[model samples]
Target: MKKLDVTYSANIGSYLGVPIILEDNTMFGTLCAIDPSPHKFDKKDLELMQTLANFIANAIELGQAYEIILAEEQRVKKELELAKKVQTSVLSEPVQLEKINIQAYYQSSESLSGDMYSWFEISPNKFGVILIDVMGHGVSAALISMSIRSLLKGLITSISEPIEVIKELNHHIFSLFNSTHQSTYATAVYMVIDTELKTIEYVNAGHPSGLLFLDQKTMKRMDEGSIILGIFPNLKVDKQLIHYNEPSTIMLYTDGLTELINPVINDAIHTVENIIIGEPDNLQLIEEIKKEFVNGKTLKDDICLITVNVE
Candidate 1:
């Protein structure tokens, strides 16, 4: 075990003339053969011992490095799974509501997403729908969207007005980010549809303007909300009242749908017109809208579409 210079071989058992390297990087004294006749060991045997020591050192280093990498990978995967659960929970669980027929879609650019949709029946005839897009994508944005969703569900229950809901949600979100200095915000559209009265009430807050498909050849963009949410406090949202005279299709969506850089928004509007132009049916129009967005092409951001069919 001693790491002395080329000296004191006899004291450390050099009977066989075989040299050994200790695990602690120190060379052990040699052990020579026990034959009566004098014999000398070759240089090749010493070289082999040196090579074996190097291999052991390398194996230990590699094993430690591999474990470190695997640990990191598992940590990331667990975080991602948690985020997915949160995102999915933010959506309507059953995906079906009474009186108001809903069709919506969401696509994310990564494992975690920034887009979210929340909807519930306010009454037997009235339904509230909210679609939102946080500033960025992935875990941070998804968590923020989830918070907004929970806050809205609580806020909307007491308040049926879209404008008031946005104003309150904005203040809550702004206060949250101010404490953290995150500077995050969301673009949203809140719509309240009354089937009995046959009207659509909306409060837009810096969202992509929506389009109302009146007939096969006509469609009008509805984009009259105030500033984006989470930016200012007590801001007023523009309210629009859409009167549905007959059984027609109404489209409300996130910016990802129209602005995917595919120029499909215009075509999408035209497509809606083609299907429901002359006389639109509720069931038939929803099928066409789903076929347009869900098939053939993929969306870059979260794409959500909610359609109301007036009976």
Candidate 2:
């Protein structure tokens, strides 16, 4: 006390204080009081001051904890936004060729999507298309989708067959999840089109079947495939080929579109089939489907749709 500098005032003569310490043995501040006259505090008075200091320390700790929680929440929110942007930017745009027309629509139940669709030209007349659904929602699923996109982009350059591409993807996903002791799965459909041959070769990995519309009155669904990817390393992917003699529309979609709840459309699949057969153009079909199934209500899962018209 003698070594410390004191500020003498006319009215204040004495001061009493107790250190406010946190649970981690860190000092937050001091609980202090001042008196106008020179005074000596009793043991009871000191005890009371200690109790008040403990209370102040607890309050300070709580405030700090709350700040940390708030910061974490904001960080998560920003990460989700960034994830959404990354996922959206990776989606393929509508492709128009001399003999083929492609259109796609995508929507997520949340800010991040697990569903993804992509298509690119494999050769001068050959094109590769894929649709995938990771078995979850939000950031984790979105990350997996992004990884799948990267893998597909690299694989498509070397592999021209849909079955071999799916096999490689399954092997990669299986190996990754097995090493981490985590179980994650995804359903996918991949198709490769040869314009010169007028044929489509495709493989489905536990996803819903894609429809082949021969005309307004004739249609068929491609339903042959294997189990979901990442379930096992040794998956037998069956590849199917179809030769189209005339112009046809092939539609691929996630289960979210087939499971939508609409009062007017009792069966979502039937509604989609009706639109594909009835609508004259792809844009009208897309707009009509959105109006019927997705305009007003929140989706229960991520929705992805891809239509390829071969002429």
Candidate 3:
């Protein structure tokens, strides 16, 4: 009572206060009660006051934590948007050449996709087409994919051959992200089309089988896929080479499309083959796929497809 250091304590004959501390041992503020008349506080009264302070501290902490979480959510949303933009930029448009008309369709279950398809004009008469699906989805797979995307043009141009391109890809995965978890890898289909040679040379690394329409009635399943990329130091890859007997439409896709159509991969492939056989033209096939899968259904994974027409 005699202490002049107490600010605004002149009218208050009694005062009780306790500091509020968070669970992390950080001090927040003071909890206090003041009265004009002096009153003695018992152990129970002090305990109750402390208990109230603890409740307030917990409430404040909860509010703070909620705010932090909201801020983090907004930050992640913005980052994913930016990443989607960057990812979209790298994806090449369909290569509409004189002898070949290549078209691609891509959709992500999330803002960012692990599925990607692109083609590079390796030479005047030849172009390289690739479609890949990383092991899982989201940020980690996306990062790995972008890293691989950066290397695609050079690798496809210099290597040229499908077998060597995939082997070098495996080597890169092993060398670059060997630090990642064991399951970090991607299934891919790399193809080199020579319009002049009239041959399609391709390598499938644990991806879905590509569909090739030989004629209106006949279809060939390109299922000679080896193990996935990012596995094994020494890899043996046999490139499959096929000469188009006539004007043919070749479809390369990730597993996401098949997985959506039917749980069984082979059955889904069969369904897709039937659909493509019904409408073999590039635009018609893409339209059919949209009507069946992308019309109203919500996808569970990334879907990417590439179509090449040899005329």
lDDT, residue 116, candidate 1: 84
Candidate 3 lDDT trough over 10 residues, lowest sum: 1-10
**TM-score versus the correct structure, for each prediction:** 0.73, 0.81, 0.86
lDDT of 2: 0.84
**Rank ordering of all candidates by TM-score, starting from the highest:** 3, 2, 1
Put down candidate 1 lDDT per residue, 1-311, tens digits, no spaces. 34334434434323244444455666545433443333454678666655665565566657768999999989999988887876776577433444456766556767788788888878778888888888877888887887787787677777979888888878977987787776888888888888889888888888876666753335777778788988875787779887776655666667666665347767755554555554355455556655765556665666665655555
Query: In model 3, what are the clashing residue pairs, if there are any?
Result: none
Cα-based lDDT for every prediction: 0.70, 0.84, 0.86
Candidate 1, which ten residues in sequence have the lowest lDDT sum? 7-16
Task: Report the Cα lDDT for candidate 1.
Answer: 0.70
Candidate 2: worst-modelled 10 consecutive residues by lDDT: 1-10
Question: Considering every candidate listed, which one attains the maximal lDDT?
Answer: 3
Write model 3 residue lDDT over 1-311, tens digit each, in one string.
45444634567766789899999999999998877776676788789889999999999999999999999999999999999999988999877778999998888888888888778999998999999898788888888899899999889888788888899988887776566545477889989989998899988898889999974557988878579888776688988998875789999988888888999988899999988888888877988998997778898988899888887
Sequence-dependent TM-score of model 2: 0.81
- Segments of candidate 3 deviating more than 4 angstroms: 1-41, 178-183
| Alpha-carbon deviation at 224 in model 1, angstroms | 0.7
Pairs that clash in candidate 2: none
